[model samples]
Structures are given as structure tokens and as C-alpha cells.
Target: MTWGKVREIRDGRCGKGRAGDGKESGGGRRGRGVETGQSLTLQSLTQWKVPDLGSGEGSQEGERVKSGGICAERAIAKHRAQRTPISSKNSSDCPRTPRHSLNMGIFRFRLMLLCLIGSLSHLNSSVADEAEDISHKDADEAEDISHKDVHCGVPVNISHGHYEYLSHHDDDTYLSVIKYACDGPVYHLEDPEEAVYICTEHNKWKNAKLKYKLPECHKVSCGVPKDIEHGHFEYVTTHGVTSYLSAIKYTCDANYHERDFSDEGVYVCTIEGKWRNTDLDFEIPTCEPVLCGRPVVHLETHQRVVGGQMVVNGASPWSMLLRGADGEIIDGALIAHQWMLTSAHALQGEGRSEAEIKANFHAYVGIEDAREMDSAHEVHIDKIFTHPKTKDAMVYSNDLALVKLKENITYSNHIMPICLPAHDLAAPGKVGHLAGWGMGVELKPATHLLYVELGMANASQCLHQLAQKQPGLFTEDAPDLFCTQRSALEENVCRGDRGAPFVVEEGGVEYAAGILSYDEACRAYTYAVYTNIYNHLDWLKEIMANH
Candidate 1:
């Protein structure tokens, strides 16, 4: 028979027997129901067909039963084979009633449900932990992206200046320290406070506080004052936190006098971010003109003659000797009380220190005889100013220089200053007088004090002769050079004539028209070249006034 039909019949029989037993067996049946329910629940679990463990309806315990379904069925079949029929079974041998079977079934179903609930609980806990780990990873990745967007790329660039950048890990902002680049010119901020700029995560720059604006490289300038005439400014040094403090000194040129007679005229940068004199409202000094007179002797008395005649005693009073360490090197003119003019080549040498060159020179004034110095006034050389463009073996262009004396010389009838020519004195066939200790005939020793009258040579004829003798030496007619030929065939200037003045009388005043620069070998009909002092009058005056 079917198990359902047999269970119905068993229930009917238990109901009849329970009615016959009455109230006295009530407690005993209830106690036995619990014990039998437990025992039968265990057997039912082993024999029943397990449901398919699908979806949320089943658990790991149910899955085990489903996997062993065939084994469970075999166990149930064996149990049935050993069971006795209900019709012949004694009531005492099988005391479990339908009520106990019902209780056992309920207990088994409840136990399975509890097992399913526990499996679901464990699955949910695993899912929650995995989700938490993924969420944390996403957060870290987002933070990295944010950091890269904020501070990973290049910082903003500045022109004519530079900046320093600093970043912090916890902060989302970057700091920019701005500063000017040190180059052509330097500048400083008026305020002493520091300026800072902030760059935010959004890639925007903001100035925290700007007390003063930074100067552009092109705008930075040092305006030298122009209040003084015939003077110039010179840089000494610049110092300050922002390079705003500038030290400057002033000077005057040759044949000019400073107001205070001091060489040091220094100025410093003011706190107002301006360059000014240390003594504000101080009088702006000027370079005053120096008065000079003609020599005491007549020009006709110092005329040149054949065989290079010796000059009369004290006739060329302005003529002075440039004495080096060994002896006389060249001739110089007394242009002022403390200034002498000569050739730059006479005082300049290659690879020589300025001190060494200055130490080598001493001026001897009022001397007619080169061999005798007892009557000469010896003056120490303070400084030597050479022409800016004077170069050795370069055709003697701009061959000029000035000598400053340690002390002013006392003027006397035997010593005086000659006048500087105000206009061009170079003309064809014009005669000029030259005085120096140049070599005489037959390469003999130089005349004690020699004089020569030279006639100005034709420009074309001079250039032709120079090109024929020394090709490529005479390039073109220079503004500061003139050619002259001796009045007689054997009366030309020689080697020692360099730096001597070529004087020309104008209205009773002897003005220096030229200076002996270079000459061809001592031959008949050869021409000598002289530096045109008239063309450089302004330049000479300027140098004297500013130096």
C-alpha cells in the first residue's frame, strides 16, 4: 500500500487506542511522543527524498542530501524490507503513533531550515567583506587621480624671472616663491616683506599679498645724473638684498679742474629705490677751463736749418723730455700746469701693468740739453691716459696720450704752455716748425735740442710715395693724420723726433698743429707723417675734462 494510506490508518488506530487508555496514560503518552519524535526524525532524515538545492530555498545541508539521493533511497528501501505490517504488529512493540510521526516530520523540517539559514548567513558575510575591500580600492584610486591633477604636471613659467615651487602631501595646494633672475641689470622690491603665490588643485594662481610689483628685466635701469658738465659717472659696486644699492664715482677729463680738486666723487643708492649723491642737495661740480699761454721765445728764433740745427737755450720752453727708467724716450708738450701731451705709443707697451708703465715715466721740463738735467724740473707722473683706439703697428692712428703730474709745475720764462690749434692747420705747401732731440746726419747721436721747418706734402703725392715704398700700409687719408716734407733735402725728422709738437704761428700765438708720428727712412725727398692735433681738439678737451 501507499505510505500516505498506511499513515492515515495508523493515525486512526492510535486515536482509538488513546481513547481506551484515558486520562491515566495521558502523561506517559506525551513523554513517549517527544522521545519517539526525536528517534523517528533521525530515521526520516536518512530515508526521505531531498529536494533540489536551488536558489534561496536550499542550503549547503540540502545540497549534501541532494547529491546522496540514491544512497538515501537505498537506505529507505532496506528499512521497509525489515519493517512489520501494521495489521499484525503489536501495539507495545511499535509504540510511536501518527502524532509522533507528525512531530518528527516537523522537527526534521525545522532542523533543515536552520541549516539553510546558517549557510545563507555565511554567504552574505563573504559578499559584504569583498564589497568593502573593493570600495576601499576605489577610494585610493580616486585620491591618486586627484593628486595627479593638482600637483603632478609642470608649474607655471615666468618671463624675465624665476620661481620656486613647494608641495605638501596632505595639502591640496602648492606654494610658489617668486624672484627675479640675476642678469644684465639688477633690481629690488621697495618693501622688505616677502611675497608668495599659491597654486590650487584647480590649476589657478593667486597672489597672497603684493606690497610692491617686481620689475621686468628690460625696465631695470641705473639713471646716472647729468647735472655736472665735462664729467662722467663710473660704477664701483652694487650691494643690497635686492641688488638695489649702487655705488658710483665721478671724474673729470684732462686740462680741466674739478671744483673740489678731489678725484673721488662717490654716490650711493638711496632708500627710496633711487640712485643719488650721498650728500643730497650737494652742489653739482663742474670742470673749469685752464688758462694757457704761448712760449716766451720768438718762433723765428726756433727756425729749422740744414743738418738739423740745435735749438737755442730755452727757445722751445714748452718742449719737455719724457724720461723712462733708463733715459729719455720721447718728447712731450707742456699743455697745462699739471698736464703734458705726447704720443700714446711712447707710454704704452704690450703686457705691461698700468703701475709699471706709470712708474717708468718722469717729465723733465725747461731742459735745453738732453745730457744735462741740473736745470730741469723733475715731475713724477701720476697717471697716463692713452687714446682708446691706439694699437701697435697699425699706422699710428689716434697716436696721442696725456700725462698727469703729481704736482703742478711753477710757471717761468723758461717753462710755459703752448696753445692748442682751434682749426685745421694742414694745407699744401704750408710750413710748420718741429722740435725734438732727433738723430743728425750720418745716423749720429740725436741733437741736444733740434728744430726742423717742414712744408706740408701734397696728399696725393704722399699717399703715392707711401704705397710705392710700403704697399698696403697707407690705406687711405685718415682725418687725424697729415704729411709733411723737410724744407731742405737733408733736414727731415729722424727716429727720436716722435711725440714732438709741430707748431704753427697764428696771430702771434704758437698753436700745436700736429705731433710727429712716423717717418720714412732718412732719405732725400722722403715725407714724414704727423698726427693732426687740430682734428682731435674736441676729443682732447673732453678727455681732459672728464678724466
Candidate 2:
């Protein structure tokens, strides 16, 4: 018997023992009735063959094999071995129930087989229904996953950088968002508020820019520098790029300088994207107009005398040296961009004519030692204006003159003009400096320049002192020149010192108080006659205005 049939018997679907499945069969025979050649089904079972175990023919079949289903396979094997006609090739020819087996009744056996087949068919139907339901469930889950993938587009990408999601999400739904960022120093968000984007209607992202344009990742930058009032700036590193790590240097224009001494005017890009000077913490440096009369140097504070110690470089920036066509050098003072003050007699020195003086008249400055004049920037003289009341070269009254230069000067620390005095009267007892050209009185000219300090004397003292030399030149009431006397009664202010500026410092600014006009040939001691500079302010202003 097949395992299926055996299971049916084990389920108690055999003989008269079953009630709900079908009617009784072989009421007391203690055996199952089944059809050997018919396929089982729930609706049909009339072709069963029942054996007569009461007769010797049935007894010889399986009494020794045991009738209980506990040895069902062994009993079936022995019973099939006992088939008649030596078990013919066709199962129908194997055996047949004799007419005596009709005692068990064909109706009863058919009832048993029908009930067993019906139970088996119901079990198979339930399993197929459950399997179909599972298949449909799996297909729905797969469709949900595929639909999510097709709901939205790709992620956003920015120039110079990438991005990431602000928060995890199951799908790119309407309201999903991403936050944008950039590599430090090298790149940054142009608008940080726009760094985040939200998925809006139509499955598109939106930010402060409104459109779905990827937020820009621009190179970090400090914009073009602030414009200085009298200066400008230039790049020190890669040109045309104001991005991260850029460098720049600021410079003042001609005749201008940075007001703050601490600021070096060199700047660099910072990590936070600001331009800053390495040594200073202030904002952009400013360029102010050069303050006149202030020397761009530090000097020794000791007192100076007549023909005293040598002056430091940059200490007397306004002091000038003039050379004529005859190669004669004298001292002069730069008082403005194109105007200089000097002694009128120095203009006509060496007996040269006015035309000869203007032919190759050049001014040299910025050097104390003449040998170091590697760049002798020769500024040509455009014109000369001698005082209207000035006498001959041998006279001392009205001895001051003005020289106009052909080109305008761009002032610097080494070549700046001195400030003019505010009042026109020579202040009595005020001390002043007189720079000396080392053309020694009886000796050859020296390369280095020297300076001396002198005190202005009262008009009576000045006039009394001058009367001893040029006796008839002036009186106390209306002296033609003022006197400056050295405290130390040492060497005299002589010929080579002609045209030197008597510079006085007031309120930290140097001003031309007088011009050397009548320093005798080393004969007069401790005192020199200078053409009054303050008294000639009106004439100086008028000449400069007309020019």
C-alpha cells in the first residue's frame, strides 16, 4: 500500500469505525477495504475489493504477518507476495476477490474509500490557498520598494564641494532636506543661509536662491581692499584672485605716507576670510599728506654750536645744495615744491653773470656726503628772482633771493620742504640751526656737511654787532639784517656758509627764519648776518603766487 493510503488508515478512516467521513464497512472484519486499480477522489468509491478473512483462503494471506497497522508495510509486502498466478505482469491479473468475499458487501467497502479520499482532497485544497496568498503579499512589498526609488531624482552637487543629507529619511519625499558644506579655507559657501535645501513640490529642492540650483561653493575671499585717500594697493601673490590665502601690499603715493607708524601696510588672508596685517590689528591703513619740517629720523639731543658736529642723514631734509655753470656750490633751502630760498649774493658768485648762473643751475639734496651722490638727481633751475631792493653782490641789505625749479618735487623722508614761519617778525632770543657746507674758509671743500646752532639777538644788539663790520649799512630802528650769534666763541660763519638757511624749530616744526647773507671771511667771531626771512614773507608769498 502507498504511504497516502497508510496515512488514511492511521487517521481512522477505515472499516465501520468512521462515522462522519462515510458509512460502515466489514462491520467486525478488522480490515480496511480499498480499490487497487482506481484513482481516489472525494465523490467516487464503488470499485473496492474486500477480502474474506473468515475463509482459509484469506487466512493464508496475512495471519502470520499480523493484522494490526503497526506492521502495515510488512503486511502489505507479504500479502502481495502471496498473490495467485505467481503475480502476473498486470496488476488486474494479480488477484481477484472470490465470490465468497461478497459476504463483506461491495456497498460497505465503497463507503470507506470515499470518506478517506474526501479528507485527503480537503487537506490539499487548504495548502494551495495559503501558498497563493503568500505569493501575492511578497509581490506587493517589492512594488513598494521599486516605487520609492523612482519617486525623486539624484542628490545636489555644488561647485568646489559636495553635500550630505541633513537627516536620514526613508525616501526622497516632499520635505526631505540636505545641508551643504565646503572644505575649510580652500572653499566656502557664498551664502551660508542657503546651505540647506528642502525637497518641495514636484520633487524639486528649494533654498534661499528659490531655484534648484546647487548652492555655490566659492573659493574663500576677502574682497577688493578699501581705497586709501592718497594711496593705493597691489597684489603680492597670484593676481586677479581675491580668494583664500591671497596677499597684498599697500603703498602711499608721492608726498604721502601712512599715518600709523605701527602698520607695515602688508596684509594677508585669514582663516575666517578677513584681510589683516601681520603686525597690526587696525583696519586698512591710511595715506596722509607728508607733514612738512618733520625729519624722518632720530637725532642726538646734545646742543649744537658754530661749525659744530656733523648732522645725521634725513635730519635736514629741506637743506639744499646748488651748483652754477661755473661749478660753484653753495647752500640753499627748499621751502616749497618748486621754490627755494637762498642769499642773492650766492646767486652771482665767482663773478658769473645771471645768464651763466641759470644756464646749468642744478639743485642736489638727500645726501650729507657729496661722494655718496650716486644718483645726483639734478633739478634744473627755471628762473631766479632777486629782491627788488637788493644791492650789488658786495652789499648786505635786501640780500635774499628765490629760485624756482623747472619741475615739481615729489617729497620723501630724504627730500622734504620746510614749513614757513607763521609770523613775519624774527622772534628775539629764539635759537635756530644753520647747516654748513664744509667748504672751509682757507682750505678746500669737504665732502661731509655740518650744522650749527645760533641764538637770535635783539635788533639793537644785532645792529650794534653789524656796525662793527659793514658800519654804514643799518641803524637800530631799521636794520637791513638780523644777527644770530653762537654761544661758543669759536670759529666764524664764513663765505662757504653763504645761503645756508637759519632754520628755527617751533611747535615741533622747522621753519626758515633767515638766509645767510653776510658771514665775513672767517674774520668775525661767533656772529653772522642773515637776510631777515620773516620780514620778507609778503614778498615771498607774492612771488610764489605769481609763478
Best by lDDT: 2
TM-score of every model versus the real structure: 0.44, 0.49
Judge candidate 2 at residue 168 and give its lDDT.
Answer: 72
User: Model 1, range 1-547, lDDT digits (tens) per residue?
Assistant: 4656434333332223421222233223211122121322334334544322322333453334333433343345555887844331232233323334444554676587456446545765798999999999999888767756564234344454454544443243434334334233353333333334555555555554543333333334346555567667666885322234667666555544344423246665554445555444334546554345444345454444566667663557788887667764678888878888987765564545568866776668877786665534787788778777676634567888888888787654456788898789889887878888767777665747878777888866776777677765564566677888766545788766788898887776788888877743456547887788887887788877976
Name the TM-score of candidate 2.
0.49
In model 1, the runs with Cα more than 4 Å from the true position are 1-293, 301-305, 349-353, 374-376, 471-473
Worst 10 residues of 1 by lDDT: 28-37
The number of clashing residue pairs in model 1 is: 10
Angstrom error at residue 446, model 2: 3.2
Query: Model 1's lDDT to the true fold?
Result: 0.61
Displacement of the residue 305 alpha carbon in candidate 2, Å = 8.5
Minimum summed lDDT over a 10-residue window in model 2 is located at 16-25
Question: On a 0 to 1 TM-score scale, where does candidate 1 land against the true structure?
Answer: 0.44
